[model samples]
Target chain A: MADFEIRDLRASVEGKEILKGVTLAINKGEVHAVMGPNGSGKSTLSHTLMGHPGYTVDGGEVIFKGQNVLTLEPDERARLGMFLALQYPVVVPGISMTNFLRTALNAKRGYDGKDKTKQVSPKEFRSLLKGELEVLHMDDSFLPRYINDGFSGGEKKRAEILQMAILKPEIAILDETDSGLDIDSIKFVADAVNRMRGPELGVLIITHYTRVLQFIKPDFVHVLVDGKFVLSGGPEVADRLEKTGYSEWAEADEPAVLKPEEVA
Target chain B: MATVPKVDVGTDYKEKYGFFVPEDYVFKAKRGLNPDIVNEISWMKKEPEWMTKMRLRSLEIFRKKPMPTWGADLSVIDFENIFYYLKASNKQSTSWEDLPPDIKKTYDRLGVPEAERKFLAGVSAQYESEVVYHSLQKELTAKGVIFTDTDSALRDHPDLFKEYFGTVIPPADNKFSALNTAVWSGGSFIYVPKGVRVEIPLQAYFRINAENMGQFERTLIICDEGSFVHYIEGCTAPIYTTDSLHSAVVEIIVKKDARCRYTTIQNWSTNVFNLVTKRAMAYADATMEWVDGNLGSQITMKYPSVYLMEPGAKGDVLSVAFAGKGQHQDAGGKMIHVAPNTTSTITSKSISKAGGRTSYRVHIKMYPDAKNSKSFVKCDALLLDDESRSDTYPYNDVDAENVTLGHEATVSKVSDEQLFYLMSRGITRSEAETMIVNGFIEPFTKELPLEYAVELNRLIQLEMEGSVG
Candidate 1:
């Protein structure tokens, strides 16, 4: 069964529609990539799927684990095994990474009780975090420091990936994960994301570049233009996007005033 | 990575530290202050004649002093309605078993005895108006460390108490100071011999139990030459319909080459007006540090100050304040440079939520003879909602040359981006807010002991829960 399915999902921001009927589904053990041009409602889709309060779902439903998740809060959807790697990780000045990660993990486990036995053990958590740190080529010394405080752009991306790895969600979405990264940092982040792949996990990567696909290959690629997907194909579509760019679909969703018969 | 216990804050403040034991006092004075009441307080304690004279003089000072039109509003503090004195017991004991059953139940409920036995070097507990239980580690006592309540220090170590008492903070320093001097009952008093280093911290816990009661505790600590000691104070009060007044005076003297650290974690009920005066003097090459956390009270006006008295002296103040609904927290620190080659730093952080208001008010002064002295100040404030408010009132007077002074401040509201980011990680809204707040004050909390840090985090969690919804 598919872990996530969106049926004609329509969303808006500030009374203006940004996502016009987006439809996609990701089943278990499948990697899907959504490539879109600028202003194509790419981030709107990611945030709306995660139930961001700023975005309003005007119509349609998002079915996850046999439940319509559009009515739930962001945290509720998150605990239901859906995760999103924010493109711009928030800078929390005084909280350490260990505290945030442990809290998130335990929260997913539904361990809100006072009984420590039900929660993740400190030893188990430390080992899990240490392994993820090794995968990301980061030292354990970063654990005690504040999360994303005074971190470089590349470091922020890597931290977001580390959060995804620690949560171990059933379905995870990466929003513009490779927007701005140097050569070495991109390699480290791609390698970490690739290592997190499993036969049971559903992966979705949204990006504007195909360079990241060279490391973490996608099973299916869909092109989104003007709030609607225009093309769907295999991994070769990313290569085609790199070569042809997105000018062909600048107005693909709706024909211009000059071209009346082109719509038919 | 230890799991944080669940906090029962889905309710109001009445559930935590707000339960009151029935009023049981050996001697409950009249419901007003006068010369006769002051004399009766002195006579009830059997204090020396000189102390009685000082109390009367302080009473006159209290009456003569005018209320300054500054800081948090104090017109709500009706001095005529406050019970000036309530003697819980005349028999102060060194053992908890020897205490009255009700007072013992109060301490037991607070977990004071268990905490003192396991972690602290010494402990003094004040119930209504006097310290009822006292204990010090034998090893520390053997090292010539004098650890006792302020009243006993006056009777047992009269010469030492007379020498340092009111020396750092004079009676006329402020109206609160004058009131504390006149009716001060229970506070910690410590005297460390020269060169003796007491590694563990000494603590005192005070509580106000009666309605409209006024608690004035006087604390004095003398770190002899080259000696080192850390003193901590914690306070709480029961929820009362009428306002309670808690005015305290703490004085410290760090002698030549000595070091002293004084930490206060004040968590009174919201019906109390906590006006305090705290000051310390550091001699040549000595150091003084104040770590204060104010998380309670309807109106709190306190500014812990340090004076770099001689050359090579150093001073540091790190404080945090949290003002919840219907609360106003006016808190900061003061540093005065009097000698050359002295250095001081002040860090203040405040958070206001749910129509609460917090302000950082500080005074920094440097004299002409304080040449080549350095001072740095930083104050940061956070507002959780549009209804909350924050302000900064910094007073700097500098005259010395060849000195470096730096100040930086930032006011912020919890951003939607930060909250969404944490919520997307499966943390609830209130939990995320508490986490962010805990992080904002991490610098101050990291300086505390492990157990204290955990307790503080829980307290912050309780406060943040009320802010949301």
Candidate 2:
């Protein structure tokens, strides 16, 4: 029961369904990748799992550990050990990355009131931040800069990884984390995720290309097409889809993916 | 990460500023207002012939004008009972050593001297009705930079003071402005010579150290062609049993090809009613920026305004308002584009927590002949608790068809998911709320000077305490 389970879940954004009945489970101690072509609900699935306000759950349930996540708010779910590395992480002006991380950390601690712990001292927090920066190869100035403001493509992804490292959420869903990164940046972020993957950590990496998976080496790969997972297999599936593209899935989901020719 | 349990002060935080008002100070006039007191204030200032006449005229206007029916309620304002002027010190001090000890203590408590020693190029400390300490670097003064108290400017550089004072905002501009014009006291006067740029910012710290006192500061800034200057003004008043009034009038003139930025942060005690009139004008190719923050006051009504009077000129105003219980922060900006190719942007962020009220009232107008003008106004509000109230009222008047105008506003409550996310990370509920609130006002805080921004965030955190169950 110490795992994330989605059972035949369906969701939609703005009244338009983007996630069909689907089932997937990721237990603690594994890295799973959901790869698909554009408009295949790959990103939507990730957002729905995180309970993005724009996405509404129409059916099924998402159980994080034993609690039904659908009953919880996004921040509540996050406090429940879920994190999302957004495809386009919001650029919040005026909020420094360091300050944002500190607030998030304190919020998580508030729930675990059982431990009578003192707030992290500024000195210790700064040093811990410095250590995280060193691991991510980020500059010291990045913390003072506004969160993701004026950040380049690679820097934004690196920032997301740094947040994941700091908060250390139990279940991390990285949505298109490798979309705009160069090969080197992709390698760095993938390595960061790999280093974070352990028996105590579970990850759901959402991406369109198989490039990032090459380094992260997911334990499982799933093909999401037309709002539904058409196939699920081991890491080899990413290679097959990368070579053939979405043509086969496009033909198979003609009814589910496309509308019938309208009367003119 | 560890969470610090919130300390329950049981309303003791409100009492922290209880002694902010000094009791021993003698009252020059009663709490209520009257024409006799206005005349007495004029008599005390020992003004020039024309200045006294202007004050009498302003007083007459104030008497005849009706209280504003819009915005915050003024029924609580007993004009006849409030003193027009109360001088804490008889003379202005050119150096810190000459200032009265208590006044100096006030500045020391507020860290004005430390701030000056660290970053400020010049400092003006106004306590009660006069400047107790004023000084500027000789290098800046030698560069033709003029910085002094407004009254001092009127006495020494009358020509410069007369040219810009009341030009941007006239005495009859509004009732509060008229009241301020009649009883105006200590405020900063700055002039950046043509083609001269001030490297470090000039700061003015205004404090109301006496009880039942009304502070009417008049500030004037003139930046000549090709010149640049950044001025910051901050105000703090001790909490008092009876309400105090702070009505200030600020006028700025940014000449052609020059730039000026005026920043104000006010943290008045919950009992003070702050009514202020601040405006600026920009000439051809000039720029004017107002970065204002209003965090504390029982009732605050301030709108930093800009008039883009020449083509190629620009105006930008960014403001943030936080209203806690029993407080009403009605603040925003006004942008008037009167020339072709002019542009203006106003971004306002407000937070209303614990049954407090915040309103964003903005106005953007482009003249009929002003072609190619553009104005964008965005107001965002975050409601932490259900009892709090927030409103956005923006007016966009575009007479010129060629102008592009846009206004967007959104009122959002703290996202539960965002809160839960922070909690799972080991942060407390209060800390989570603080993060969301900070993020909501990041646009405004980032625009403030570093130290000022830090203080603003800390104050917000303090106000958000006990907000979570």
Measured against the native two-chain assembly using Cα atoms, what DockQ does each of the candidate structures obtain, in the order listed?
A: 0.69, 0.28
Looking at model 2 chain A, which ten-residue stretch has the lowest summed lDDT? Answer: A255-264
**Docking quality class, candidate 2:** acceptable
- Candidate 1's C-alpha runs over 4 A off are A115-117, A250-264, B1-25, B89-135, B205-214, B235-243, B467-469
| lDDT at residue A212 of model 2 (Cα atoms) | 78
Please give, for residues A186-252, the per-residue lDDT of candidate 1 as tens digits: 8899898887788768888998767678888999999888778888989988878776777577563
True contacts kept of 2: 0.45
Q: Candidate 2: count the clashes.
A: 34
TM-score for each of the candidates: 0.87, 0.69
Would you give me the overall lDDT of model 2? Answer: 0.76
For each candidate in the order shown, give its overall lDDT on alpha carbons.
0.81, 0.76
How would you class the docking of model 1? Answer: medium
Q: Tens digits of per-residue lDDT for model 1 on B358-429?
A: 999888899998999999999999999999999999899999999989898999988888899999999998
**Candidate 2: segments with Cα more than 4 A from true spot:** A1-93, A101-161, A167-190, A197-264, B1-27, B89-140, B206-214, B235-243, B398-401, B466-469
Q: State the interface C-alpha RMSD of candidate 2.
A: 4.5
